[model samples]
Target chain A: MSDIVFTNVARNFRRDGKEFPALRDINLSVRDKEFLAIVGPSGCGKTTCLRMAAGLEFPTSGTVAVGGVRVTRPGPDRAVVFQQFALFPWKTVAENIGFGLVANGVAAAERARRVADVLKLMNLAGYESAFPHQLSGGMQQRVAIARAYVLDPQVLLMDEPFGALDAQTRVVMQEELVRLARVNPRTVLFITHAVEEAVYLADRVVVMSRRPGTIREIIDVASVRAADSWDRFEKIEDVMDQASFVHLRTHIWRLLREQQAPDDH
Target chain B: MSRRTVVGIATLLAVAGLWYLLTAATGWVGSARFPNPAEFGTAVKQIVTGGYAGARIHEHVLQSCKLVAMGFLVAVSVGLPLGLLMGWNRRAEALINPVFLIIRPIPPLAWIPLAIVWLGLGDGAKIMVIFFAAFVPSVINTHAGIRNIEPFLIEAARMLGVRGPRFVFGVLLPAAAPLIFTGLRLSLQASWTTLVAAELVGALLGLGYVLNAAAQDIFPAMILTGMVFVALSGAASTWLLGRLEQRVTRWRTA
Candidate 1:
């Protein structure tokens, strides 16, 4: 069975007595351990798609199943990293990472161990006591990532997780996400507006059409795993400069650009 | 000290100098209604050392503080949870809000006659009035605080498998805290404003009681003394509230 599946999903939201459809006739499947990115314009239900699988949103008419079981509500099996980082302002970095584990009734020692592991892995070793506001935007997003990663859920759902960061930070976060997937492979249903972001991190990029969004195309990119080295950042940055990376990015950009223009008479 | 502190002290001195000049020096304003600065100073010394209305000045101040603390605490204990419920659950809001709206617009001082009839001329009536004053603002602001929580925060919490009470206390409350504290501060101010008004009905020991008696006797010095006490206490409470708010919401600062 696929890690996640959306079978004929449609979502409708009502506003002022009008039933506005956000997504329609959506059918997709994410293979186990696959990193799938959905790239689309704003208001195109890319987020709606990710939220449906996360069980934060329910499809109006279709089934969202994970591991062959239908999703009825949010469960520990799937974890989400939101765009705003949404780290609890009152909580220190360690507390935010340990939140889910504590809720799950993990023993204190084990929770601390897991939290320490994620913080170290995310390169946030000594800053565990700092609050979210005390950290930079990039560091805050790293805490958010560690928050999700510590859960070790079956699937990670990211909704424009780095969209708020500056360009340089966004690139670094993307590389961090790639390294995370390499070390501990899991299904990731990633959504982004940046074509390069989608192409860089995804195993297969799912191009979504405009409103009442459905899958337009799914392009498979060559996978580049993190090399076992201290200089992982340089190796990943070099992946972006490859000819295939440029070619694929241009192709996705053209597809998105073409969809934005009005159809010819 | 800070520049702001220097400016504040300067402003106070300037205002006092103007009042002294007008009433004591120029005699442009009569000292009957507005006591001269020297007489006011003597009254303060007399009240602090000698006594006012057969009770020490501190006794009256302490009594008023007790009334406000009791009423404000009761209002918060009841209103905080009630408001949180109203904000969280639609049915609770529908059931409770209409009556709250109708009664809220009627000022707490307006409740004096009815409170006297119901609870009699005692501490009960005074506290009831202060409670009403504090309760309305507390409930309204707490409800608003909960309602104003960012939708993204709720979404993020739910996505992390947080729900029910954990979500309410853990996610909702902290997110709504800045506004909740704002509600508390407003409620506290309301409690103080209505304290003297509450003490008007047959009370004989509070600052309000002393001031009322002094007003009948046309003792401007006593009135000014009472005003000074009220001003000082109000400033103290506000400063305390500010410190509390700052400490609780330190996370808001970068």
Candidate 2:
């Protein structure tokens, strides 16, 4: 069964007496355990797409479904890792991770056990008692990831989850996410503006056109994973040379540049 | 000693020295009005020994503390929930804000006459006056604290399956706690100040009553002692509130 499905989804936002369309005709589906990255320029509705999937926002038209069920509101079955590392500032690392479980009426002992496991998985074992403000930005994001993961959601919606970190930290977080995806096999709909991030983490990278965003192309990265002993950085040229990757990147870049151009109208 | 402790002691000594200097410098001009430090100390001793107007200073201090405590409790109990509702619901804010706006500008002292008329110049009137003094800032600060919380935090909580009253208690309250405590502390100070003011009219046993009686008797030393007791109580209340704030916010610092 498809883990997530978006059928002709549209999102329109109203501001200052103007109706701005954020997403238009978004039609996509992800199979079970698929790692799909949605890539687009800023304001290209990538985050809005993830928010819609996570049920934080409603589509102006059509439906967003997960595991064959339509989404109307946020639930514990689908967890979200926000871009801003939205860890509760007043809560300890452990408390933040356990929040979802607590909200769902899990026993204290069970909640603590799950929190402890994620803390170890995220390499944050000794810092469980530390407040979010006390942690570094990278560490805070780790807490956010752990919080989402501890809920054992059927699908994970990550909205540029590593965008706030330093470049080195971002790479490390990306690699960590890749490792996490490998172990858990959760259907993850990741969103990012960075082409490299989308290419590195996704099983298939879905490139999006600039605002009033529509899917430009979907490039399967399965071949890159199939290659043995390949260095991601070293094989960048080879990866880009793939007909699908080339076509998708070119189409997306052209769309973005056209949107940025100065127009008299 | 810590720098804060040293500075605090130095300030106290300087203030005491100034009081002594002022009384001594002004003695010839109004000996009945201003008392030197030694005379004030003598009056304190007399009060302790039941030699000053046959009323013990301890009774006045106790009465003032009781009134302040009762008024502070009443203010916090009413203000916090009102503030939280106003902050959490836009409709509640719209409905209640006008009332608070009209009432807030009038000083608590202005409520004294009404309180006395309603409650008959008793403990009820005194407590009501103090409550009126403290309630506005407490409610205003609590509302500000809740309103100032980042909207992203609320969205994050909601997305985590925390909604309704559970969300308010589990997420919103903790997030707004520090600022709410600040409001509570300010209200406590207000209550302490208003307690003395309330006692000024027809109160039989408070510090203010004793001070007024001392002034009428031209007993400058007794007046100074009464003023010192009032200052001490205010300082003590402030110190207690600081400790409470530290305890409440310790988790955020962890």
For model 2 the local lDDT of residue A186 reads: 91
Judge candidate 1 at residue B70 and give its lDDT.
Answer: 91
Native contacts recovered, in order, as a fraction for each? Answer: 0.54, 0.73
Please provide, for model 2 over A1-265, each residue's C-alpha lDDT reduced to its tens digit, 9 standing for 90 to 100.
Answer: 5399999999999999999998999999987899999887677898888888888899999999999999999887888888888888878888899888888899999888888899999999999889999889999999999999999988988988888899888877877887777677799999887776777678888878777898987887766556632335443456556665666566656655665525512
Candidate 1 similarity to native, TM-score: 0.94
RMSD of every candidate to native, in Å, equals 2.8, 3.0
Highest DockQ against the true fold, candidate? 2
Q: What is the DockQ of each candidate?
A: 0.59, 0.70
Q: Residue A241: error of model 1 in Å?
A: 3.2
* Candidate 2 interface CA RMSD, Å: 1.4
Best by TM-score: 1
Docking class of 2: medium
